[model samples]
Target: MKKHLSIFKLKPLSMLCFTFLILISSCKKEESDPNEQLQDGNSTVITDLAGDTQAAMGSATPGKEARPFYIFLFRLKDQKQIWIRNATDSAQWLKGKDWDLAFTGPYNSEVYVNDKKYRYNPGFEGNAESAVVMLEQQYDLVDQAPSDQVFDASTITKIGWASSASANGWFFYSLSTHIMQAIPNRTYAIRLPDGKYAKLQLINAYKGNPPSVTDLNWPAPYFTFKYYVQQNGSKNLKTK
Candidate 1:
């Protein structure tokens, strides 16, 4: 007697479903990789975090300019970015320690630490103890933060474009070309309000973090930067 043979096969509909599932999986993996590998091979680096992408094209008035530009507030601990619509209301932001860094002023280039006691700061009269100090070293090379005494003695609030010293801030403006460019090798070492330490690298201020932007009308205020926060309450910020 001959034995009967039977074979199971996938139907056309089942084959289609299997292909769709594979495509969905591939898309999810691409979206999940939002971070780049650090040189240290142990730490991950956040990449291309875009800030405010809107531009302040002044109102219909001929001579009157836009009163307030939107402020982009950031928290280093969770890597959260909030856009403040009501730019003038300091009470909302100062109500709590929700923000660590702020991007305000034209093109959202003027950055500040949420130091409440500092006059003219967004957190004025509040309880935040955050302070910022400019570091001359590159972002990846900064292994440690400056001493607390140095942060206590700092007086800088704005860390964006330097009108006087071209190399002082994160970016420089070309007077002849009327273009703004992010200066290379500029990083900020910040003292968080909770006394934690962080180092920030402002890579670009224009859209896509382009290497070279020549047009004055290029989409801007979309800041791209990376930062590392030391969660252990120590100054060891070795990203590389």
Candidate 2:
């Protein structure tokens, strides 16, 4: 009888040890690898502006000079990779025909995407197919209170003009004597040629610090922003 009891206790202890080993192996397999993350589609990216100082708007004569503009090419879902380019002239812009977004600059504030012009309009809803709408204010960086705002299609209207030179054009940049601002809180909604929707927000234009007249050559034209592109062909910004 004593021998039989010892045998039963040994069996239960052996099973318990086997179960613990299996649990540990399962946990090791479930660990996430950062290197396997997606590089382009359905992911957010930040990049610097690409252009020479000679192409700046106020750097030289207006019509005689070319304004620096950055072009971003987002590949289609069926494609393999993303193509990005930066240009300072019409010829350069022509080379980037596949681009989905444009950051037109001298000051590097205006943004054009999907072959349509956009502006910061506080009152209007931002969701027209042919229009670009953004709010005309800046929110605190740490707070990020504007992220909660709802965005969708049909809430926007097309502005009359193309560039900032016109009276009724989209005014995305704000500059004053004492202060210059980019209205960072504004979020833009756009529909791509591929029938996809995306939401973008401009984070910063300068590299180390905000632009100043005295500090022109501190490695400027760096553009940083966060974007979410809907992968399922839905107009809803939250679907991403």
lDDT per model, in order? 0.72, 0.43
Question: Which ranges of candidate 1 are over 4 A from the true structure?
Answer: 1-52, 57-67, 87-89
Best by TM-score: 1
- Encode model 1's per-residue lDDT on 1-240: one tens digit a residue: 121121125667866787798788778656653233223453334455554543444553433345566677877767777777773555577546898888877777778888878787767777787878888888888999999999888777768787755446787877787667777677789898888998887777776666788887666666667777888999998876
Q: Give residue 60's lDDT in candidate 2 (0 to 100).
A: 51
CA RMSD (A), model 1: 8.7
Model 2 misses residue 157 by how many Å? 9.0
lDDT of 2 at 180: 29
lDDT of 2 by residue, 123-200 (tens): 113232223445443312211212222333334443222235323233334333312234434556656645566656
In model 2, the runs with Cα more than 4 Å from the true position are: 1-43, 53-97, 116-130, 135-180, 209-217
Model 2 Cα displacement at 185 (Å)?
2.1
Worst lDDT run of 10 residues, candidate 2, spans 139-148
Give the number of the best model, judged by lDDT. 1
